[model samples]
Target: MEKFRIPAMRYRGLVEALQAEEIDFIDEAKEFYPLELVPSLEMTPYPHQSEALVAWKLAGRQGVVVLPTAAGKTYLAQMAIQSTPRTTLIVVPTLDLMHQWYAHLVAAFPDAEVGLLGGGSRDQTPILVATYDSAAIHAEALGNKYALLIFDECHHLPTDFNRVIAEYAIAPYRLGLSATPERTDGKHADLNILIGREVYRKRAEDLAGKALAEHEIVQIKVKLSQLERERYNQLIQTRNDFLKQNRISLGSLQGWQMFVQMSARSQAGRRAMLAHREAKEIALGTDGKLRILVDLLAEHFPARILIFTADNATVYRISQELLIPAITHQTPVKERHEILTKFKEGKYNTLVASNVLNEGVDVPAASIAIILSGTGSTREYIQRLGRVLRKGNVENKQAILYEVIAEDTTEERTSARRRGDNSPQEEKHKSGKLKVIYGTGKKQDLKAAEQLEINYSTQNKDVTNGVTDSSPKRRRNHPQET
Candidate 1:
């Protein structure tokens, strides 16, 4: 008799191959053990979650489940764990999610030993939750430890660095979860092999009234100041001239990449890049958007509001100007936690953040979301909208997302792109809970002594019903709490 050693990750595949060839072999690579695990509390799965669980089971317990955020994906994961009572390893994208999953497991499976494998702690319990970075770094050691693997925010697994975590795991059963599974780089196709094919999926709109709060996405177009518009046009003209001289077409597939590569080598290209950036900044950070924001705050005051911006500069600006609690990536963990705690407890009525709260973090129920600015990614739009779709204490809560864009600038196209429109014209009569309203004139009365009247009466009759005058006294009397 002859024997050959193999990598632990190849255990399942090698066994299947050998079985296919009708060859006899001794197996000893698996180190995972099955156990009897039970939940400490009773939970009834929503119809979608139960259907997702069934679909996953029918797919041989190896596949991805696509559910909108706040649609009870975590509960489905718990059910999967109970069904497959094997040593399990859950890999999350962030330390915050690592802690969240750890807490959920500890409470759900009180009899089973659960442990953390990230954030400066390492334990070898039956149930382990680890961050992607830690799991990938320690892949070799943990190759055969778990029989089941669950990847949260699984869209991140296809990255060059993170894919190795799945490649090195010998787990016989795998589950991937994400709100949006498609990747911009097209690496999401790799999920078909990394985790099994997607077995279940439900769009955010599909579960709006049932699983998520009924929501309306409102688009408001505001004009730039005369001087700002002049500067923005001049910068765009400079950038366009450079692009023309270099024969670069941003409309082409590789045009942007080519521009990036060409821009790093010459002063003219650098100037073009800077001009483009300045134009974009002007469009994204116009003061007119701020005026609209002030009105929204006054209209929806004391409602748990989440204000999103594309840059930290605007986040800090709004925070300093309006005295709202701001959370950026630079915010310290303890401070961020405290702010969110206050927000949850109603000590703070509003929070301003720059992309950090787009996904993963456990944000309390916020019925109103004001998007000052953001990129043209549908995933980002969905995540931002999801922040407010979780039903709160208010009955028949209708989540409202106000997207403020700079009219006549590139932002109009960006806004349309994110909303799945090919061009600005296509978004004019877009239906199904989406209403577009354009500013009638320029905002000339932004001075402190003037009342910023957001009169939507001339535009949409429906919008005018909610629009109101923001008296200077009331606008200046905003909360000064952090």
Candidate 2:
């Protein structure tokens, strides 16, 4: 008989299949290492955290733990390290997160040598933290060195290329952590094969008043200027003409991509594609949104606020116009670090960012989050909301998120779709026929709703609350919450 090895992620399936055929195989991927656990700090896990640890251990030390951003996921990871004392490698998505993990690990185990393999540093020790890019580059060489593999923001692991790190590593103990594990392309299903099943999960609402800060989502409707509105309508008409003539449904799964490919074949198609982009830009970056933003900043003065935009151009424009520090992919590592440090120190009250801060970056919690614009992805919305949902000093300070939407455009549809609810108001919003309709979560004041051209019948309900439950649920074999 020949001896063969398989990835630990597939251990359960392979073992079950082998046992069905009456084949005997030895399991040795998790050989114990002579690693010492030096207690550097004393910290206690939350009740749900302790439950998560129990669920992970019950799953054979291999599974993903889904928790909200500020619900102490890092502490749970540290607890995992202490429970299973071994050479461990923690992989994070960005250098900022890598450094954050490194510092936390160092404080958790002061005597243990903590190494970093990203941001031009290449130190290897019992507890090592590396960025996803660096880990992918050196996965083969460091495959067999560690007994535990921890993936922070582990939802990124299922990508075609990033999966190599997990596949190449022989570590038998694996833990994946993320606030939201669902992906637009549905590759999150591959996470079950890459790491393990999601063993524990807690949503934003599940821990709202307890673990996470109590929060409220506010939706503001704004109108474009006449000139901008004219241009936007023209561009939208141009794109719609092409779609209607070609019988292309932009709502299909591969519709946008197919449109891109077909649009490049001729001048008309190219014009249509350009019109689509310009129309989107005009809708998302309308002058009205900026005016409202200025008002919001003034209203929330002295409160730390995070401004999220759909693109870097808008980010820079907001940064320049408002004089707030901006961090994008183009920002240097050192500059990003300094900006975050200053923000944490309360020197900078407001920060504007594109998509770079959406995941895994240890951003200092802010009291307010203003989303000027974003994609239709629920994950993006949740991550942006999470940036401000961390517990704050004021016990009753309701973390507020304002989703600014352009009235009477595809943006309204995008906002409704991302909210994952198909109420009558959403149907009306998707029809691209509605004017501004603003309502607080409280009982709708008919006079106020009518004054703003709102549909009281639909506006009475809270669409923002629906956003909190939009995230896809993970099926767990064991009870998720204790």
Candidate 2: C-alpha RMSD after superposition: 14.4
Kindly provide the TM-score of model 2 when superposed on the true structure, using C-alpha atoms.
0.82
Top model number, lDDT: 1
Report the C-alpha lDDT of model 1 over 1-482, residue by residue, as the tens digit.
99677655465566556544646455455567666777895587777777677666656567899887877778889988887777899999888888989899989999999998889998898899999998899988887788789999899899999888888887877899998889888999999888888887877777777778887888888899999989999999988998999899986459999889888989989999999999999998999999999999999987899999999999999999999999999999999999999998889999999999998877646889999999888789888988998875567778888999998988887788778887764223222442111112222221421223221122222211111222333334331111
**Model 2 residue 34 lDDT?**
35
**Residue 65 deviation, candidate 1, in Å?**
1.0
lDDT of 1 at 458: 24
Provide the lDDT at 295 for model 2: 99
User: Residue 427 CA error for candidate 1 (Å)?
Assistant: 5.4
Best by TM-score: 1
Query: Model 2 over residues 124-234: C-alpha lDDT tens digits?
Result: 787889988999999887776776789998988998778998888766678999988888888999888788888877777677666677777788988889999899999
Query: TM per model?
Result: 0.85, 0.82
Candidate 1: what lDDT?
A: 0.79
**How many Å off is the CA of 111 in candidate 1?**
1.1
